[model samples]
Every structure is written in C-alpha cells, then in structure tokens.
Target chain A: MTTAAVTGIGVVAPNGLGVADYWSAVLRGQPAIGPIPDSTYPVRFAGQVVGFEPDRHLPGRLVPQTDRMTQFAIAAADWAVQDAKLDLSGFDPLDVGVVTAGTSGGFSFGQRELANLCHRGPEHVSAYMSFAWFYAVNSGQISIRHDLRGPTGVLVADQAGGLDALAQARRKVRQGTRLVLTGGLDCPLCPYSLTAQLAGGRLSDRDDPATAYLPFDVRAGGHVPGEGGAILVLEDRAQAGARGAAVYGEIAGYGATTDPHPDSGRPPNLRRAIELALADAGLHPADVAVVFADAAAVPELDQAEARALAEVFGPHGVPVTAPKTAIGRIYAGGGPLDVVAALLALRERVIPPTVNVARRTVDRAVDLVEAPRPLTGSAALVLARGVGGFNSALVVSTRDIVDR
Target chain B: MDAFTLAELIRIMRECAGEDDQVDLDGDVAEVDFAELGYDSLALLETAGRLAREWGVSLPEEELTQVRTPAGYVALVNRELAQSGAGG
Candidate 1:
C-alpha cells in the first residue's frame, strides 16, 4: 500500500498567517489570545486571527457566498497547493480530493440571515443561505473553487475530527487517489456562535487575555474559543517524490477512539488511542520523541489527560507540549493545527513550548517541556480528545522508504 | 428605476455567480443562453433576488424559470420593471 506524505502546510492561525510566520511565532512563544473585540459576546477572550484580508487571498465575488470558515480553508489550501508546487492546471482534476473537518458552518452568515428573517422578514435573507450553513460547505467550496473532482467530504466530530479528516485523506491516497487537500477550519468568533459556545459553558469567562487559556496551569479556568485553521497537501509518497515535491513528514499512523460515556467517571479511553497509533506505526512508546497534547484546560479534563499521559508513556517518558494553549480551542481546527506544529517541530528539531503555562499543575509522569526543547528524533505524536469523548491520535515521522 | 443595461446585468451575474468566468456583455453574449454564459439556476436566483431587493421589481419565479438566454432575462426584467411602474 502507498503511504501518504505531507508535501505542504498552509496555516491561517491566530498567531500568524503563513507557515513561516506561524512557525516563527511558535518558536518565539508569541501569544495571540485576546479579549474579543466585539462586546456583543458574553465570552470575553478568544484567539481571533488578526489582520486577515479576504480580498487579498480570495476571489472577491465568492467572498459574500462563503463564511469566514470557508475563506480560511480556501486561503490555506491555496498556500498549501502552491507550497507543494502542485500545478492544478497540469494535474488530472479527478485525482485531487478534498476533505475538511468543520465544527460549525458559517456562523456569521447564518446569523445575518436569521437576523434578516427575524427583523426584515424571510424574503430579505440572502439566497446563499441554502449553501452556507451546511457542514460540508468547507470541502464543497474548496473543491468547486479549485475544480478538484476527486472524493470530497467533511467530518464533524468537533475538535478531534481534524485528525480524522487527515486519516481519511491517507486512506484515499492508499486506496489509489493521487492527492488530497485536507484539514479543519472553523470560525466561531461571531455573536451567534459565541452564544452557542457560552451556553455549552466550556469557554473561559476570564476577562484577562493572557490568563484566559492557561491549560495545565494551577488556576486553569477553561479554554478560550479560537478562529482559523490549517490545510495540508497529502500526496502519494512515490507521486510526491516523482514530482520532486519536498516531503515534510509521513502520516505514519492514526488511531481514533471514544470514551463511551465520558461523564460517567470512567477514565477517558485516550491511552488506547495512543497505543493503537503507536502500534499502527510499528513503533513502541519509547520511539515517540515528543507529544502534542489536547490541553482542553478544563480543570477535570486537564487532570484526566495528564493521568492518561502517565498511564501510557510512564513517568516523564516523552517531552509533552500543548502549543494550542496559545490559540485557544479552535474546535476542529485545533488538532490539525497541532499536527502542523508537530510536523514543523519534527522538521526543525525544536519542540515548541506551551504558551500561558507558568508551571505544571497536575502531577503526571509526562515530561512537560516548559521551554523550547531541541530534540533528535524522526517521530512525534499528536493527540486530541474532544467533547463527547472523541479521542484522536496521529503518528507522523520522516518517510521510512527502503530501497534495496 | 432605469432599465438594467447589459453592463449592469453582467455585473450582477458576475457578482452573484462568483469569479471563475467573466461576463462579456458583448452582442454575442447578449444573444447567448445562460448555460453558454457559464451561469446556473443559483446565479439566476441570486440575481433576481438582488433585483427585487434593490429595484423593487420582484420578477415572478415562473418568469425567472423561462429566462433561458441573456435577452430572455433582460426582457423579463424590463417587463417586471414596467409592471412595477419603474424601469422603461
């Protein structure tokens, strides 16, 4: 079977725009979490992408039809394709597929239409309403805009679904598709989505921006919501190498599990996901040099994650980091972004530190890297567990191609 | 409201249908079918909706369904505008 290799990464993140800017910000440990500029939201703080001009990156005519989430997906996809040097004009349209993970559809667009219906009557709603709010809009719009006719889909398992989307891409590549553009992007910064998030009560009500999303810290209140996402170009390893594409890393393995009943006091079934991923990669626990944690920052959830980490890798076993703490919880975007960070980490040989974490709160066996730690390993593990006990783990490593 | 010139209709078509194809507004385009113009029903729906909202000329859905060509769309819009007592 063919292996899936990551040839390119494009990120529209709260801390930065492109991969270079984002990686640099990660290395510098920059904070993008801040108070929501719009006072209409009850949740004060969030990680909103700053200074993103849609007209600059997207076609202006389609801008009104798409939600911010779709726009982010397009922008990041464009960058990823360009970075991979994949010529869309030269490739067979049927060979390129798109899969995206979306937590919510267009919040801002839906809010406007609903407002029109409530205040100005139903007739005033824009005709685009039929297309925007559906969860598949991200993938559909990307495929339509880019003319990619291969197997296109969207996964909606909230945050952890990001890795699941990439896994689907890997499956498609292994099944014979040549290229897949896949990731997660969700913009829930608008008023309606904020109200939805506030009702869920997972968002931090903290007024201070710096301390809003202090995952694994002693006084961790909760996670802050965030916007934007990351898109990756996954191609068949031989196809990528034949095209002279630069490989970032290989999607060696992926494992998904559910906690069954997370609120029933049973420990989250995260260790199983980790073990399964490592097993799939044909590597043991000792081979994983670093780990990207979920870092939900909800007190009980954080402790549970810590204990799970301890159960699998043992005391201070692997250098664990939670860089998503800086960007807040971007729902579906969170995990894939962490995967992008992990790929970059593997490439740079430097493990990025968790932002806003002053000191380790829960006592665990995992070695939490508070500073940027340099490492010498080819493999890294990225973990994510979401609402309703969705657990996802991905194993990414240098391409292990052997020729005799 | 003045009748929608070919230019205005092209702009509306381009705006509503997205940017993949350009709307030429030339005589050849004016005589062509919407399918030949790279437009679909969604674009027509949005264009007609925008006209109703902006020009107060709510073209009937039946009339919109009959609009196969650019000339057909323009004639229907002109007739609707005449009924709304606006466009000549």
Candidate 2:
C-alpha cells in the first residue's frame, strides 16, 4: 500500500504555540496546568493556551466567523502548508482534502451565543453561531478557506478519533489523492466543557497543582483537561519525494480496536492494536524504540496501559513516555500531538521524557522513561485510548518506502 | 427622521452578514440582490435585530423575503421607522 509522508506539523498546545516551542517545552519538563482562577466550578485547574490572538493568524472577516478552536485549526493548517513549502502554483485545489478529529465543537462560541439568547431573545444570537459550534466546522472551514475540496470527513471517536482521522487520511492518499491535511483539534477548558469533562469522572479534581495528575505512579488521580490543535500535512510518499519536501517521517502502519464500556468489565484490546500496527508496518516489537502513552493518570487506566506495554514488549523493557503530562489532555488533539512527538523523536534520535509523573507510590512492570533517553532506531509507537473504549496505535519511522 | 445613508447602511449590512469582502459595498442595489452577496435569513434576522436596537423600529420577517435588493431593504427599514414613529 502507498504510505503517507508527514512533511510538516503545526501545533497549538498549552505549553507552546509552534511545533518547535512545544517540543522544547515538552523536553524542559515544565507543567503548564494551573488554577482556572475565578469561576465557582468544582474543577479548579486546566491547561490553557495563552497569548494566541485570532487576528494574528486569521483574516478580519474570518476572525468573527470562527471560534477559538477553529482559529487554532486554521493557523495550524497554514503553518503546516508553509512548513511543507508546497509550490501550489500549478496544483488543483480540488486535488487536496482535509480530515480532522474533534471531540466537541466550539464551546466558547456556543456559550457566548447561548448567553445572548438568555439575556435578549432568539434574534440576539449571532448568525455565525450555527457553524461555530458544529463539530465538523474545523474540517469545513479549513477546506473552504484553503480550497482543499477532495474527500473530507470529521471523526468524533473517543479521544482516539484523532489517530483514526490520520489513518483515514492515509487511506485517502493511498487511493490516489495527492495531499491530505489530517489532524485533531479541541478546546474543552470552558465552563460547559469543564462541566461535561467533570461529569465523565476522568478529570483531576484535586486542588493541588503538583499532585493533580500523577500518571503511571501510585498517586495517579485523573487527567487535567486542556485545549490545543495539531494539524499535519500528509502527502503521498512518492509525490513528496518528487517535490523534494523534507520528510519528518512516514506513517508506516496504524490499527484501531474497540472495547465494551468499562462498566461491562471488558478492558481494551490494546495489545492487539500494537501487534496489528507493527505487523502492518512490517516491523517487530523489538524494532519500536519508544512508546507515547495516553497516560490518563487514573489508576485503572494507567495500570491497563502499563500492562499493555509490558505484554507487547515482553522483556525488552521498551521505554514509554507520556509528555502530555506537561500540557494536560486536549482530547482529540492529544493523539495527533503524540504522533508529532514521535516523529520529532525519530528525527532527533532521542526519546523525550514524561514530566511531573515521577510518582513512586505504585510499582509497575512497564518501563516509564522519567528522563530523556537516546535511541538507536527510528521506529516509534504512539497509542491513544478514549473514554468510550476506543483504542488506536500507529507506527512511524524515518525509514522511507525504499528502505522497507 | 434621517434617511438611511448608503455608506452606514452598507456597513451595518456587512456587519450583520458577518462578512465584509464578499459584500459588494459599491454594487447597485437595483441591479444586484443580497442573495448574490451571500446574504441569508440568519444574516437578515441579525440585521433586523441590529436595526431595531439602533433605530427603535423592527421589520417583519416576511418583509425580508419580499425585498431581495439592498434598496428594497433600505426602503423597508425607513417605512418601519415612520410607522413606529407615527404609532408612538
């Protein structure tokens, strides 16, 4: 099958705006999560992306038409296209497509319009509200704005939907499309969003900042919520080669699996997902140098993830890291961000460390990397499991098709 | 009552439409329709709300459908302002 080369990346994480800043912040091991300040919501803290101005990246007309999340997507897509250095002078706009994963629509925009309705009347609501809160607005707006009108789609999977979206984009490229912008975006830090996240009982409610989300250790509570976007430019490997675009890495293989609800007592089949992705990449478990974990920090979820890693790697003790510990989980954006991190790791030949997760209170068989480690191989595994039992894994490496 | 100036009205219309570049601010309303400028019911309603808030007069939703041109829209708003002033 034809593979997709990730030529460029655009990130809007809580800790950083550009992909370069984000990766460096991840390596620095600083926590960006803090108290949400004023509001009376039981939820106290979240990872908020600061210093992002919609006017800075979006046109004046587009600034009002889009919500914060959509703005992030637009900026990210632009950054990726520029990074790829695409000479679209003779290219057909319809030849390209967009696929994005989102867990919820624009919460901040919806909340504002809803407030208008309550205070004034139905007529008081802004006309743009309809599109702003629609879950697929990112994909639609990105396609319309950039004129990438090929096969477009939006995935709303549990958190894993982001990875699933990339896998789908890869499929589109393999089928003959020349370019695909595949990524994930979400911002669930607002009041309504936080309330919903709290309802799921997966967010850290602790008042203490340092101990709120301790994944892989005994003190693991739950994940702190965040908002971010990661958009990638995925091109046909051959086309990318012909264009002489710099390759960060190619998505060699990806696999997805589902499990019954946690109440059903059916844990996720993550081990199977790992095996399938490696096999799809024509690689063995020994070939994978690092693993990016979901790291929900909830005891059961962390234990399950640790067991999956141990089962797959056996005695190899493959190093695992959950760099999201610094920025919290941005739902749909979390998985794609991990894929970017893995790609950068392959490029730098080093494994980034998991931060603020040195909780020694629990013992596990999995080898969690608390510090950065040098790696010998380029092949890496990135995993994401969502609240509703969606599990996804993808294999990425510096190796091109010729090497395979 | 002051007549609706084309510049201010056009600006308001573009604001209500949540668009500026697509709106042909210089287009002859007699020749061009709002539909051609990408105006829709939501924008119309929003425009109506803003107009009512600013001028203390409102247009019936049905009147919006009947008037497809910007000049028609201006005439309707002016007529409503007169009616509201007389009734008061």
Candidate 3:
C-alpha cells in the first residue's frame, strides 16, 4: 500500500492563527473561550479566531460573497500550500484535489442575508446565497481558488468527517494526485447556529465563561462551541522527496465507524475504530506512545472514551491528552486540529497537557498528563468521536524509522 | 404568549437571520426565506427545536418547513401549540 505523508500544515484556531502561535497557546492550556464580540450571537462565550481579517489572506473580489468559514478554509489552505514548498504555478490543476469537512457553512452569511430580507426584501439578498451555506462551499471554493481540478469532494459525517477527508486525500495522493488540500472550517457562533446547537444538547449552558468547557473534569457538563479551520498538504512521499520538500509526518492509517444512536445511551464504537486504524497502519496499540483524545467535555462522553482507551491498551498506560479542550470544540474542524497537534507532539516527542484535565475524576488506566510530558513511542494515535454516531481514529508515525 | 411576541421573536430571529427590518406578529412570512432572515436549515431546525423546548411543544420538521416568513412561522407555531397544548 502507498503511504500518505503530511508535507505541510496550516491552522487558524482560537489560540493563535498559525501552527507556532497555536502550539504555544496550547502548551499554556489557558481558556481562550470568552465573550463573543460579534454581538449577534446568543451565547456570550466563544473561541473566536483572533486577528483574522479575511481580506488580508483572500482577494478583495472573493471576500464579499463567501462565508466566514469559507474564508477560514481559504486562508488555511494558503498557509498549507506555502508550507508544502510546492509551486503550483507550474503543476497541472487537475493533479490537485480539495477535500474538506465542516459542520456549519456560511451560517453567518446566511444570517446576514436573512436579516436583510426580513428588513428589505428578496431583492436585497445577494446572489452568493446559493453557494455560501452549502456544506461543500469550502471544498469547492478552495479547489477553484487553488486551481485544483483533481477529484474534489466533501464529507457530511458529523465531526468525524475531518479525519475522513484526510483519509480520502491520502487515497487521492496514492492514485496520482500531486497534492491534496484536506481539512475543515466551521463557524457556528451566530444566534441561528447557537440555537441549532441547542438541539444537539451537548453545549455547555453554564454561561459562566471560565468553567463552561471543562473536559474530563469531575464537573464536566458540556463542550463550548468554537470556530476555525486546518488544512494539510498530502502528497506522495517520493514526489515530495523528489522536490526536496520538507516532510512533516506520514498519514499511515485511518479508521472510522458509527454508533447510530449514541446520545441517549450507547457504547462508543471506539475499539473498532482504534483497532482498525492500528491494523491499517500495521502496528499494535503498544507501538503508540501518546494519544490525542476527542474530549467532548460531557461527563458520559469522557467516561466512555476513557473506558475505550483502557479496554484497548489496558492499565499498562500510555500518555493521553486532549489539547483541543483548551480551544473548545471546533466541530468538524476539531479532529484535524487534533491531528495537527499529534503530528507536532510526535516530532517533539512530548505530548502537550490535556488542558483542564488537571483534576481527572475517572481513574484512567492511561497516564493522563495534566502537564506536557515526553512522548516515548515513535508512533501515536489521534482519536475523535462525534455526536450522533461518527467515530474516527488516525495513526501518525515519526518520519525517522529505524530497525523497528 | 411572551415567547412569540413580535419584539422578542424578532430579537431571536435577528441573531440567525441577520439585520432586517422590525418584524410584527401580522407580517407575511412566505415572502421571507429563513436563510435571508439569517437562519440556515440547521439554525431554523434549532430555533424550532428551542421553541419546542420553551413552549412545551414539538414542532415537526414538516411544520418548520412551512415557515417561509416571520409572521407565518409564528402563526404556524402558535397554531400547532394550540392544537397540541404546547402552552401548558
């Protein structure tokens, strides 16, 4: 099987806009969730992307029509393309593909247009309405913007779609796509979006900003929603090497499954996803030294996930952390963000603390690093489970492989 | 009911639908698209769901789909609640 390598990565998260800034904030583990400056959202607190002005990254003509989520996708894609060190100026656009996942697309834009229609009329609505809120908006826009004509697609499988998008990108790369822009962007802070999330019954209604989004804590209630995007450049290892590009990590294996009705009370299908990913990577649970958990911040969700880990690796213990806890749940963007963190953690050989996991209520057989700790294993697994059934697990191995 | 009052309802609608003219209880909703009023499919579903929770009524997906305008949405919801005793 052809191995998929992650050559470049770009992130626009609440902590920081890029990888370096985001990583620094993650290590500090401070709560970035706070009052929404947007004024239109019902929920006061959110993990907003600071200092992000879409016009700076996206061209002026393109900015007026796209939604905030699409803007994030484009900006992150630009960063990933630059990081990949591949000049698309000469490559065939057909050899490039775009795949992405997002929970709410163009919600803010749709909200704006709706307000206008309510006040003025349909004539006031912009022509961009058709494209803005579509779930595939990001993928279509990114593909067109980057001139990537290769097999573009989008995933609607809840939050698990992000990882699935990367897996699809890996397949495209193996099938001869020179480069694949893969990731997700979602901004659901608008009152309309927040009201929608209310139905999910997973949002933290605590209202008290600081304690609202505590994952794996004894008082865990629910996760606070946030918005952002992350994109990675997936290319054939040989092709990347031939161009002397910097290789970050390889996309070794990806596994996914669904639980159908997990909300009321259903066991997490994590074992199947984790085991399948390990099998796909030709590795065992023991080979993985660190784990990046989904950490949804719900008491039951955290418990189930902890148990799943214990079932797979047992009490022997591996360093497990949920860095996304600090940034809040970015919905479809969460898994890919965790993937980015895992890749960096493996490279540095140190797992970042599972921010807010300082007081672990559940007796986790795995070493729950309240603080960042050294990652001993060369391989690591990134685990994520979405509301209403989607579970995904991805394996990342260090670039340097020896006689193992 | 306080939940469906023109002012309060409009306030909630403003968040999802975007900045629109003031809405009234007797306004024509079919003339408006939920997206144009700042609500997408998910947002509208969520709003309907929230109304269900607050009003103690379950607004079916079909009922919500009929909400094309602001006043129409209120009328449909109010009618459904009255018939189903959502205001208990």
Model 1 CAPRI rating:
acceptable
Rank list by TM-score: 1, 2, 3
What clash count does candidate 1 reach? Answer: 1
Would you estimate the TM-scores of all the predictions? Answer: 0.93, 0.90, 0.79
Give a tens-digit lDDT track for model 1, residues A78-169: 99999999888787999999999988789998998999999998668878899987788999988987899998999888889999999999
> Which candidate has the highest TM-score of all?
1
Candidate 1 lDDT for residue A314: 86
Interface C-alpha RMSD per candidate, 1 decimal:
2.7, 3.0, 11.8
Give the distance in Å from residue A158's predicted Cα in candidate 2 to where it truly belongs: 2.8
Write the number of the candidate with greater lDDT, choosing between 2 and 3. 2
lDDT score, candidate 1: 0.85
lDDT of 3 by residue, A167-206 (tens): 8888898888888899888888888888888788888877
Please identify model 2 stretches exceeding 4 Å from their true place.
Answer: A87-89, A401-404, B10-45, B56-76, B79-88
Q: What are the C-alpha RMSDs, in order, of all predicted structures?
A: 2.7, 3.2, 12.4
- lDDT order, best first, reads 1, 2, 3
TM-score of model number 1, chain B: 0.83
Angstrom error of the Cα, residue A100, model 1: value is 0.7
| TM-score of the second chain for every model | 0.83, 0.80, 0.66
Give the alpha carbon lDDT tens digit for every residue of A241-267 in model 2.
898888888998888888766687677
